[model samples]
Target chain A: AQRVTQPEKLLSVFKGAPVELKCNYSYSGSPELFWYVQYSRQRLQLLLRHISRESIKGFTADLNKGETSFHLKKPFAQEEDSAMYYCASFDNNDMRFGAGTRLTVKP
Target chain B: GAGVSQSPSNKVTEKGKDVELRCDPISGHTALYWYRQRLGQGLEFLIYFQGNSAPDKSGLPSDRFSAERTGESVSTLTIQRTQQEDSAVYLCASSFPPGPQQFFGPGTRLTVL
Candidate 1:
């Protein structure tokens, strides 16, 4: 069975500080990883995908097959970046999301 | 221009009753998915529809949960004899193909008492 693990339930950081949301997965074959963010009163939207290897909103994630981890990172956090972040992966033709990490960037 | 949309943003129902939640996927999207999120838990995959393939019910928790999609457009999830544990936010998402990136809906918050 494919499983995704996000250890942090909540993370707090000051503005301008670097942020990293940890994520790990267990799958038999190659997996596709994605990071989705949901702001207050907004729908969940895709932030980035490992396959694309492109940063969105200044966030990037690299898939490490050996460690089975794909962590999302940002050079500097912003107040507006505060939101619920979910790490997900494709499994059995469907996507599975993590428990989610609520990030709070204090000004 | 519209993203995925779900009807009845909020619903409150009594136990032992049934509820049907509807979802309208983005036009031209060939894949639709249904997920449930508990109060403070991760999203649970309930069902999925891709093109004309048979719906995948592998993630469904029990036989009480069933879902149907009409030709890759609109989808509806029905829960019979709802229980307190069934109370959660039901989210709908659509993607261009089978799976890659998905666009999510506002979700239907179902509360059972």
Candidate 2:
């Protein structure tokens, strides 16, 4: 079965500090990678997909086939950046999501 | 335009009872998906509906769970003999066909006591 792994369940960072949400997946025939986020009371929404190769809200993720990783990164964290982030893999009619990482950006 | 809508934002039921959750996808989205999220866990995809084709029910936990989509429009997921373990937020999402990105609904919180 295809799987996505997010090593950190919770991560805390101070404002102005850089943030990275680690995501790794077991590749099975070129799966698409995605990052989804859920704000405090908002619905989960698509942050970015690897295919797009574009940054959203100052966050970017690179799909590394060699590392099987698609880590979300932001140079400087902000309070609004605190949310639940999930990494997902979809391929071969199978979609697997990581357990998610709760990021807390302290001021 | 409405992104995606789910009925009965919350539902509480007793064990062994059945519950039906409804989802109304975006206007022209051809793909719809149902997922279950336990507290502090990732999405457990339950089913997928794409246009009028056969849905991918591979992620369904058991035969007691079944879903139907009304020709790329409204979808309903039914859970029979609900167990306490089934308590979770049932989320619905939709996207254009051949596109893997999804837009999610607010979710239906189901508590099976």
Clashing pairs in 2: none
DockQ metric for all predictions: 0.88, 0.78
TM-score of each: 0.97, 0.96
True lDDT of residue A69, candidate 2: 98
Candidate 2 residue-wise lDDT at B30: 93
How many times do residue backbones clash in model 2?
0
True lDDT of residue B42, candidate 2: 94
| Per-model root-mean-square deviation over C-alphas | 1.0, 1.1
Tens-digit per-residue lDDT, B1-113, candidate 1: 39999988999999999999999999999999999999889999998899899988888999999999989789999999999999999999999877858889999999999
Off by over 4 Å in 1: none
- Give the least accurate 10-residue stretch of model 2 chain B, judged by summed lDDT: B95-104
Can you give the lDDT of residue B104 in candidate 1? 94
What TM-score does structure 2 among the candidates reach?
Answer: 0.96
Tens digit per residue, CA lDDT, model 2, B67-89:
99999789999999999999999
Show the lowest summed lDDT stretch of 10 residues, model 1 chain B.
Answer: B94-103
